[model samples]
Target chain A: MKNSFSAMARREAAAGYLLVAPAILLFLLIGLFTVLFSIGLSFYHLGQGSLITSAKFAGLDNFQNFLFGRDLNLSRAFKQALVNNLWVLLSTLVVIPIALAIAVMLQRISKGIRLYRTVFLLPMVTSSVAIYYVWQGIYEPEGTLNKLLAAIGLDSLIAVNGWLGELHTALPALIVTVIWGSVPGMMILYFAGLQTVDPHLYEAAEMDGAGAWQKIYRITWPILRPITVICLIMGMNGALQIFDPVWIMTKGGPANATEVVNVLVYQQAFVNGDMGVANAMGWSIFVLTFVLSLISLRILRDKSE
Target chain B: MRGKHKWSPVWMLVLTMAVILTACGGNNGDSSTGSSDVKLTMWHWKVAFDPGFKAVADAFKAKTGITVVTQAFTPDDAYRQKLTGAASAGDMPDLYAYWAGPLEGAFDGKALEMGPELEKDAEWKNGFLPSALQGVTVSQANLDTWAADEKSSDWKKERKVGQIYGVPLDVGAFYTIYGNAKLLKEAGLEAKAPATIEDWIDTMNKVKEKSDVPGLVFSAKTFTLYENWFMNFVDYMKNGEESFTNFMNHDEKLSDPNHIHAIKIIEDLAKSGNILPGSVSLDIDPADQAFAQGKATYDIGGTFTYASLVAMGMNPDDIISFRVPAYADSKVPDAKVTPFPLVQMVVTQGGKHQKEALEFVKYLTSEEGQILYANGAFDLPAVKINDTSKLNGSLQAMAGSLSSESNWWSENSAISGKIGQPEWQTFHADMQKVILGNMTAAEAAEDFDKAAAAEKAKAQK
Candidate 1:
């Protein structure tokens, strides 16, 4: 009876493998294969047109070219890109905490809570590019921001060139836009986390003579820590990959003030026609993003412990 | 645990593969249509040329039993991406418009060498403006040599060079100071045609001092018309025709004391308060519109932007263009800022319909054909056509300056093709700093010179 049962189980396993084979094959051929191929192309010197006909075995030269200054001035461009990315990453750290605070505030409101939640979540659903362009219009020389400043007798604060045009303000202006767009999704995440939190703990803290701030510190944070970690991870990932605001607003102009690594990779691939270096840059970016994300996760884990 | 089974769905992986495949799907090709008759396909980004191309196809069909199919894609980069992919697959449209630069050079034997045939026919050759032919002209060196491997001995031959890649579509000065004819008249500036740099400055300053409207304006945000044309003016000020030839030969940097002088000239113009207040922030369209709506008196523009001015409801007669005049302390006294090659049409070697394709190109560049094309497209012709009576104000301005304006760097200049624009962008960034009062002219020159030298080294590599 045992032997017969084992034989039947083996047959079922074979059937299952057969059923999933097509999906596995498709993924290997198109999705994972493309990524693997791109990684391989990073080591080859693929010049401008007709990639197959023109490429040569370049080894680590492409990677070296991007990171170190070879014959080309790509290193400077990359440096600018890294600087901008740091700005985004640092800005997102601040943004996630603010989002959490807002979510906590929303939790306290009893009447018309749904309306406030809906209003807060509106930015998450709106198109990012549309929001960016709207911000652009507001940042123009004769745009709404300047007009408002002028009306308030704070006209001296308006940038000589528009906000997006000036080197000093372009990245800061972009950071504001990204934070504005990102806050809502994070609010929703915290809100969901807040619901899952055990209400008994907060009541227990209250009975122990815990104040509102003390209750939040003792009960609210410890329970919602996982959500905070998730938000930080996603926030950091999103910030590092910022392209649209800079592309639409400045084109990395006014002297490469707002150029991020992603934009650099794109320009190298498309504009500069150096796909080999572009791929190398892409791999580096992926590695950097992974390491940073892992570090964040580790730190959060340690802090909780 | 004698037997176990675990099979969760790879749903995310499947979905990702599907998206990637969708994005990598092939472009919809314009395959040959007519049966029996000799069939051909032509591609371009000039959608305006559709009517003219159709008429020419009809005419060609009447003359010989052949069918010509044409397609146009726009916003340029999309068209280029498509062409690049097509070239990789060894599928090229029989005839297509391409820019004359390193991109064209990359397709070595892919394109048919029309130069030998073009040179053999004198009547055909003379009909073309020398500058037009020179615009698309480059060295005969095969691009297989330029492949990253860098092996060329098999096809290499000494003492033979200068190949014309394709026939130019049109040519003229790329950058000009276009006056609002009405505004200039109203401002009472005696600057109908600027004879010198001082005269141009005086005219702009007069408009600044007298006119109720804004003064000199140009798009300075991107390293495009403003920086490029400024460099052209500077280069002209720096190099004579021979010295510029030497500059193209990679002997001279386009930055020096003379170039710094050029920067200061523009800086002085800005300091004069003759420039529009927020000109540094505006894009090309808004800058052109500002001048057109009587917001500014004089604006710098190219062939394309000049058309935008007219399109924005500015009268044709109200728009007048003049060359960037030679400055007082210049070596190239007769220098005028000239146009780079715009676009070229080539017949690829692998296409089955080569004869028919060449015939179409020949017809399209002929006097009659050029006239029809000019009328259809609202631009000048590559060939020296007799009539300019039908051309618009912008084209007329472009055509009128053709005789005096010299194309400073021919397309043959490997320096310009390899790293000119990239290096120029760095220079432009410094130029911006100089203009914004962040950097001095001397400091800008030093930084710009370093960048240019690095680029020149890259190009040599």
Candidate 2:
């Protein structure tokens, strides 16, 4: 009976691996393989042919040219895009704390609160293209923003050819759109995290003569740490891969004021047909995002424990 | 603990290996597995030209019993991206069409050159105009590996230099300056083409002053418009073609005083408020809309712009095509327009059905196939048009220029595509600065020169 039971346990374990095998293989094939392949490709100069025929080895050169080329052409472009990407991330991060506060406020209010939350989440459901176009209309020269400025007799504030076209405002305009689009969903995460928090903590803080600000500082923030970290990770990844709104609206134009890293990498891979440079860019972006992710984790470390 | 324990650190190493293994396995696609099949696949970016292709495809199928599958990718950029990826994958269609430049050049040696057979067949050889045929022909330089002294044996084993890899599908012009007669009439000025740069400016300023309209309008947001404009102005300088040729040969600096001065003319016009306000942000469609709404007297456009303007509700008679006016102190006595090929078809050697694909190309280039294309798409097929009276006004206008005007060479495209000219992009960027008062034209020119030198150095390495 003991021998039979051991055999059955082995069989069950084998079956478990069998079930997970396809998932592992597919993940390796599609996700992991592509990442590793890009890293290998980054070391060579490949275009116009497959790897067996065309690619020539030049290890670390592609990376060097893009990051620290003499002309400051590719490097400058990469740096500029990094700045733009960081702007998107930082601007989006600013919204999370504000969103958490809003979620907390909504949680305390018990009457018809679902309706407010639903309205707030409406933009999250709408397509990004549609939302961007709406924003584009708002920011156009004759658009609502300019009209509002004109109405308020502050006509000088109106940007020439709309805000998206101006170098000074193009990235900032995109950041605003991204933050608005991201807030509702992030707010929901915070709101859900708020629910999981023990209500007694807030009550205890109140009993200890804690004001609203003190309750948030002492009780609310501590519990929401994990959720904030998750949001930051997500926001960083999203910012790094931002392509849609910029492409749809700017095409990285008005002198490339909105040329982010992803767009440049895309241009290299497809438009310029320089896959090596593109792969180098991909790895560089990965390193950046990985560093950012690590920083987020460090920020969210359980310091008290 | 259970989750963390299950995901061992060793699994990370396994995953990394999986990535490398997968990439190595997935990347090297089946190379040139041209199977014996009567089915022909053709790829193009013109969805509007579907009926034209279908008519030709149907005729070919009826004649040869070969099935032709056609796929169309719109917005051209998507089409190029697919073609580029497919080339790496060895999955390019049996036959594909592209504008003759970096795109068609990408498949230069990979394509079956039709030089010998095409030269022997008088009917096929004589069907296309010289310029039309020239657009699709692959020059020696375009075949980067092909040396001037290379023997026929060295030339793809069966082909030599000066061979044509593609045949033209249609012809069109770029950078056609459209004069709005309606707007000009409103300004109480005669609607006609100006002969000199001063005259053009005078006419534009008169319209701007006399009417509530800008003198000119363009989708200046993109680099293509500026690049084309820059070329036109450069063509007006002393030894215009020689200068252009020298520039293409990489001997002439992009920041030459003459080139910078030429660009300055356009910059000055914009700085003087001749171009529409916020023109830098306006795309082609919006600029066309503004012109159609009578907001501008002159707009830079292409062959399709006429149809677009008409479609936008302008009368055919009100629209007229003229080459951009030239500099008075220029070497060229008369400025002429240049009409280039719109599309060309080529059969890839990478695929199996080469003979069948060639037959279809032959059919498409035949008189009947050409007629079907012209009638259906309202486009001028590459064939010699004995009678263009029945053609649409826009097409007829383009065809009329074919006899008198020069044909723009594919040289610049080849050179620029090959060299990765960073200076052109820099020049394009600096024009914005020039107009915005951030830099003078001279400063932009100096930067352009520096950028060119930098690019040259980079390329040499």
Q: Best TM-score goes to which candidate?
A: 2
User: Local error of candidate 2 at A294, Å?
Assistant: 0.3
Candidate with best lDDT:
2
Q: Provide the clash count, candidate 2.
A: 3
Off by over 4 Å in 2: A1-6, A48-52, A208-214, B1-38, B62-65, B102-109, B140-160, B229-238, B248-251, B404-420
The TM-score obtained for chain B by all candidates, in the order given, is 0.79, 0.81
What TM-score does structure 2 among the candidates reach? Answer: 0.88
Writing each residue's lDDT as its tens digit, candidate 2 over B1-461 gives 67766866799889999989755643121322322237889999888788889878776666555678998997767787777668657888999987763225344366667676688788987887766666566555555522321211133333444677778788766647888898888789888888776898888888878875778888877766756643543453445666766665557765675555546766778767787766667788888888888778888887767778988998888886777666677776454444556788888875787877887788788777787777677677777766776555667667777542334443333442323345567677677666555577888877777777776666565
Residue A285 error, candidate 2, Å? 1.1
Candidate 1 colliding pairs, count: 0
Residues B1-461 of candidate 1: C-alpha lDDT, one tens digit per residue? 53344433686688789889654542211223322356788988878767777776776665555678889998676887788777777788888888754236336367777778798878777787766676665544234234322222212222135566578766645557788888788787553778777777777777777865656778877565665555554454555555554454446654544345646765676667766766666778888888888877888877666778879999988888776666766787665444555778788875888877887788788887777777667766777767777565556656776662334454334433433456666767766666566677677767766777786677567
lDDT of 2 by residue, A1-305 (tens): 99999999999999999999999999999999988888888998665322224566877888887787754577777888888888887876688877887898889999999898888888899998988889988877788988999999998999866887677887888788888888887899999989988889878888889999988777778878878888888888889988888877777766777889988898777766678888889888989899989988997877996
| Model 1 spans with C-alpha error above 4 angstroms | A1-12, A208-214, A302-305, B1-39, B61-65, B102-108, B117-126, B140-160, B212-214, B242-255, B336-340, B387-397, B404-421, B456-461
After the best TM-score superposition of candidate 1, give how far the Cα of residue A48 lies from its true spot, in angstroms: 3.1
